[model samples]
Target: MEKNKEVSANNKVDVDSRRDFLTKTPIPELIIKLSIPTIISMLVTALYNMADTYFVGKISTQATASVGLVFSVMAIIQALGFFCGHGSGNFIARMLGAGKVKEANEMASTGFCMAMIFGIVIAVVGNIFINPLASAIGATKTSMADTKAYMSIILIGAPFMMCQFVINNQLRFQGRAVYAMVGLMCGAVFNVGLDPLLILVFDMGVRGAAIATITGQFMSFLVLLFISLRGQTIKVNIKNVRLNGFYLKEITNGGAPSLFRQGLAAAATLLLNKYAGKYGNDAAIAGMSITTRVMMMLGSAVIGFGQGYQPVCSYNYGAKLKDRVREGYFFCVKYGTIFLVFAGAICFIFAPDIIWAFRKDEEVVAVGKVALRFQACVLPCMATTVITNMMLQSMGKGIKASITSSARSGIFFIPLILILPRVFGIRGVEVTQTIADILAMGIAIPFAVSELRKMKKME
Candidate 1:
């Protein structure tokens, strides 16, 4: 018992101190402090994904393509988890800022419960129609068997995966980004280790990879659940769960943007695979999937930076400190753009080498290199789009937030995916992301400017 007490003490963040730190610290210092952990968390999570791709690439081209197809399903599942988490988490930040601890507490538990139920539903429904689900995710004839093998087990672990995301986001919004990082990183580390062990040593093939992924997720879920109960963070308690209408609406307002963003990403992935398969076959799917995974790692830093800004944004906005909100926004945008530009330059220089590092097949490298270079050219544009969407969501501007969130993946990418490939062939898929990102940034700039102008007028 004494040992347990000592550990809790070490982990605890004083509730009052956290509130003060978020609201009163220097914007640059505060955001950097919070962002570092989140950035590491995001990158580590991306590494977890890459491990599966890297190891499974050793199995077969068909095996790699199967993982790609099932990734779309994973995206949809992630959308659900983020919806529950961000919805409740943003609300929790605002409520805490308003000094409504009770409301934050209730929301924490309620959001956790919603994700649990939604995940269970996905698992049961997904498995029952596993074949059709596989087909819809763009699994081709050769890849279907491997896809099902990986996906069936992945679906069973849905509850744990969803709940872990909820707790991670909730902790971040509570200004406990470190705790969130620890929980997530622990799982990623565990997953990375198991990827080699289960996939190779046991020679269980794709099925082993799936097993490793879920076991890692379940471990992260456990760690997060335990941490959620520690410190001054909002406790995810069963007794506090409320399914009331008011809370639901609040969740809709805050979380709808994330849902649209991730949901549309899944939609885009499905379309990308369809067209890629049509143009190039299983190799195209594997190629595009590898590039997409690499881009995800590149974007993770910006997303993490945006996440750090969110709690500060929501809290200060709630506390009516408009200046701090404005300050944090510009501060993040400046640094995020610089970081992406530097990173994008490196990616552009090493595009072929990077793609080859993932899968050495000549065709896979050919497809991935062009696509990666195009994406790298426009990577810096993502900073504004990501930051603005996060700012709007944190401030509860759902309609605008959803619009901005949808721009890159849904609003723009969908139509481009439909039209571009017809005119340009496989090259169209390679270039679609570049065009969408630039346009998304264009839309994001004006929205962010307008909001800042409004704050100025109010001041």
Candidate 2:
């Protein structure tokens, strides 16, 4: 039954064009074509995130810190979604490249179903232990009330947000990034619009911001599912779920890097907030949180560009086209690095103004200005580090990919966030990410060189 769908003339034409487009297009042209939509998606994602921070910042210093505290919880949720989505999407991309469409189709549904199930579990469990969870993530007495209110609502929407990420990622891995972009755009626009309305006009404050976030997630989930069904892309059907050991193992091999990367991000954020609060209190946490979000906005472009290269790498590697994979990697790294150098300079210059835009507290500005500038100094290094992880992950080099991915937020960040503060106080927290970033470069370059050299030998 599924095979019949692919045999239809329109479907066959669609499939053939997509294959040619991924494998035969000029390398630069291909990356740009894919990068544009994914870039837009990432920027829009970053913007709505800023919108939340911007609107909520109006409430109080405690409110802002509370939202920052909730961020770690959200990261854990995203880690699980990416774990399933990437795990399944990675296999889907390679399988399609090797012309195993049925296997790709099965993996899609299996990954989607797995994400939704996990989402439900989070929703159930998170709301049950909201207070203790909030405390564990670094919420202090001043911010506990706002944190619980925002967190409970976000926890309720976990299923929708998780499914949205799963479907969006699956589309990108299938070389349908434009479809993913549109769905994500609609949700982002809606979230941005809803922010002021819910937060200020309605006087909902932190609660309003949380509601807008989850509703926007549900909106994205609906649109992405519609796009998946209406288009000629792989259909995500319940019957296609293969929950056995074989598919589960494949998902882990493909997605473990993402899990480690994002899971470590959650752990790191918890520690950052805890240490900042311990030394400096709510204002320090607020300032550091703003810096974190600002850096995320600046870095989204490189992540978007690297995402563009992932499909090219995975597809060609699966098709045994080593030259194309190598070409795309060099092209991405060269351009990505150049872009970041300029972004870092600009961000470094206007660090104080950027922090003030989020929250006008003097303490917040003092902490954020230093934090943002310190990170900006090392921003250029991230292009190589991020792309290497993406490349290794795309090619199913799980162990190597996980190591590089873990470097930025885990191996280095966890240790730095812990030891630095003991010695330098709040200054230690400000400089930790920049230090971790530079060290991560050391890990990424060697791994990338090793893989590229092996491919050269094969050639």
User: Which candidate wins on TM-score?
Assistant: 2
Q: Where is the poorest 10-residue window by lDDT in model 1?
A: 7-16
Stretches > 4 Å off in candidate 1: 1-13
**Where does candidate 2 clash, by residue pair?**
none
lDDT of 1: 0.91
For candidate 1, the TM-score is 0.96
Stretches of model 2 off by over 4 angstroms after superposition? 1-10
Write model 1 residue lDDT over 1-459, tens digit each, in one string: 999887455434355677798899999999999999999988987887799999999888899889988888888888999999999999999988887777899999999999999999999999999999888888899999999999999999999999999999999998889999999888988889998898889998899989888888999999999988864557988899999999999988999999999999999999999899988889999999999999999999999999999999999999899999999999999999999999999999999899888787888988999999999999999999999999999999999999999999999999999999999999999899999998899899999999999987777
- Per model, how many backbone clashes are there? 0, 0
- Span of 10 residues, lowest total lDDT, candidate 2: 6-15
- What tens digits encode model 2's per-residue C-alpha lDDT throughout 192-283? 88999999999999999999988888899999999976767588998898999999999999889999998998899999999999999899
Query: What's every prediction's RMSD, in angstroms?
Result: 3.1, 1.4
